[model samples]
Target: MVERMKTYKAIKYTLFVCCYLFWVASAVLIAVGVYAKIAKEGDVVDSLTADPALLLISTGSLMFIITFFGCFGALRNGVPLLKLFLGILVAILLMQIAAAVLGFLFSDLVLERTEQLMAKGIARYREDLDLENLIDFVQKKFQCCGVHTYKDWSGNVYFKCSETNPSLEGCGVPFSCCIQWKNESVLNTMCGYETQTLEERIAKDSIHTTGCLDKIVRWGKRNLILVGGMTVGLLGLEIFMICLAAAQISRIRGKVKTVNSRRRAR
Candidate 1:
């Protein structure tokens, strides 16, 4: 009995540590999402469509609340709370499976929607400095420009290719679209200026003429194995925790039953 108690205690403490770390990670995710939303420069759109930050905040908040129940339920050895946690975890797992199936069935629609959201972001780039910086960073990191192609910058009024536009940046992509030279220490902010008006051959040499949508799609395809591996690993961890919690609950109940049997015998 003492050995059983020791084993139970060890499992409980280990589960507590794991759940506590999950809680902390969720909290950090929420904080980063909030900071991104609040510190964003310029116009704030409260629209809930395709905003990664909002999605992160929502997911993190949900995880934090659910994991709170799991952590405390294990620490206190509360049967009811543990049962609730188990139910929720199962439901979440099922929902994730359903989502994956749906995503596979409607991949084309998903890609189209993704492109639309990206185009919307580009259009609203000037309205939010944070968004602008984010778009610029994506372009630089991906080594791609615009949504479908560099010509898609015409969607942005500031970069619209027209001789009549008043903005000096008319027909010009952001500096991020410019070819980055290895030895060059300074970025020429105006490197993309007037490049949109040039011929395709010339523009391709100076700027990334390819679109980001295709590059992003390609990247996702290339890393499918990695993403799938991570997903499986996380699900495996969750299942292990559930099994651990269930074992602890059973151990406690059996010990209680043994004590009750002894009392009845006496």
Candidate 2:
């Protein structure tokens, strides 16, 4: 069986470049994770995962440092350790995939949490928006929180009765309740607020307040800027790796040529 040739210098250098980037990214992620765990820690593990930024940093680090470096032996000339290199690469990819899935699951959890916050926010806004008076009027007349009796008074406010529609008088306010009350229908307690109803308003506020994940991205970006600045260092390492590969290839080729020449002379 023909033996696979050793890795060429060009390929080794390319890999070196890739690996250095990985190491840097990994260091940042692990650092951030540690910092959070130490400094702020459990304060953001859940949301950070949801934003997926930290995961990216972690995964990126693994891809470059672990997988690329692990496969470095394959750069040898005249007998490629292709299998070993490939195995390491595959393992790292699997890790990345797992991280991605976990991140997505976390995002879903955040979304659910945001929804709960929305409910709470809407309830809170009710008092501030003077929605209780509206509710009282509706309860006294229609016994619901909807607009089934009155008409649009001004802007988003409504004055109506609950005699026509009894269903929306209670806890049946849709987030999209924009119907103009015309007859003896119930008046919605928190329906009219410019563009947002009670539900929408509350949902937005809750998510913004509770589920907003800007901090994660901001931190990630700041770290990435370091990564960006280190591009010069990374580039230099890549050049060195290429030079190392070229020298190795040259050394091996000279040996092979010498062996061939001796055989021909004999």
Candidate 3:
């Protein structure tokens, strides 16, 4: 009985610690997300499809609620709450597996959808500061320009190549597409100016002519092992948590049975 009690306490405390850590992480995410939302409130664009703050908040909120149940259920030995938490975790695991399978089987569809989203982002490039920064980061990191080609920036109103366009940035890609000079002390933000109007061979000397999608695909292939390892690690942790909760539930039920039998004997 003493050994059983020790094991029960060990599992209960371990589960509580895990849940508490996750709860704190969720709170941090929520706070950062809220701050971002407030900072960008004045320049609110149609960011429903690509807003980083919304994504952070939604993910953090879900995690916060789920971990709350896990923490309280473990600390109080509440069977119903533990069962609810276990059920949600199992459901989330199944959804993740299903998403992975679907992504693999419909890779072409996924790529097409990704391309469409990238194009939308490009069109709204200047409308959202956060999105603009994100695009610039991707372009600089990948050493690539537009979604499919440098010319794709023509879809954006500010960068469109037209005789009547009054925007000074007209017919030019963002500075991110420019090739960085060796030991350059200052950035030439106008380096991409009129590059879109130049011949491809000539423009290649000034800015990256390759598209971002291809670059990203190659990058993903190169880091497949790292990405796969992280995915597996996350799934494994969820499975372990589920098992721990189940074990604690069983221990609690056994203790209750022991108490009932002792009362009957007395």
Clashes of each: 0, 23, 0
* TM-score of each model, in listed order: 0.87, 0.32, 0.94
Report the C-alpha lDDT of model 3 over 1-266, residue by residue, as the tens digit: 78998999999999999999999999999998788888884555646577777777888999999999999999999999999999999999999999999999999999999999899989988877778888999999999999988999999999999999999999999999999989988989999998899988999999999999989998889999988999999999999999999999999999999999999999
Query: RMSD of candidate 1 to the true fold?
Result: 2.4
Model 3 segments more than 4 A misplaced: 41-43
> Per-residue error at 177 for model 1, in Å?
2.3
Candidate 3 has an lDDT of 0.92
Compared with the true structure, all predictions reach lDDT values of: 0.85, 0.42, 0.92
lDDT of 2 by residue, 1-266 (tens): 12323544455556555555556767777676455444431333233323234444466555555544434543444323334444455554466557657756797775566545433323432322223333333233422222221121111212212334343333233222334345728655355332222344453331111111233334446798775567557555544544454454555566688789999999
Q: Which window of 10 residues has the lowest lDDT sum in candidate 2? A: 148-157
RMSD of each: 2.4, 17.0, 1.6
Could you tell me the lDDT of residue 6 within candidate 1? 94
State the lDDT of candidate 1 residue by residue for 1-266, as single tens digits: 78988998988888788888999999998998898887776446555554556766898999898889889988998888878887888888788889888889999998898899889988876776556777898999999999988988888889988878888988999999999899989988998988888888999988998899998888889999998999899889988888877887787788789999999999
Candidate 1 has what TM-score?
0.87
Task: Please give the lDDT score for candidate 1.
Answer: 0.85
- Candidate 2 overall Cα lDDT vs. reference? 0.42
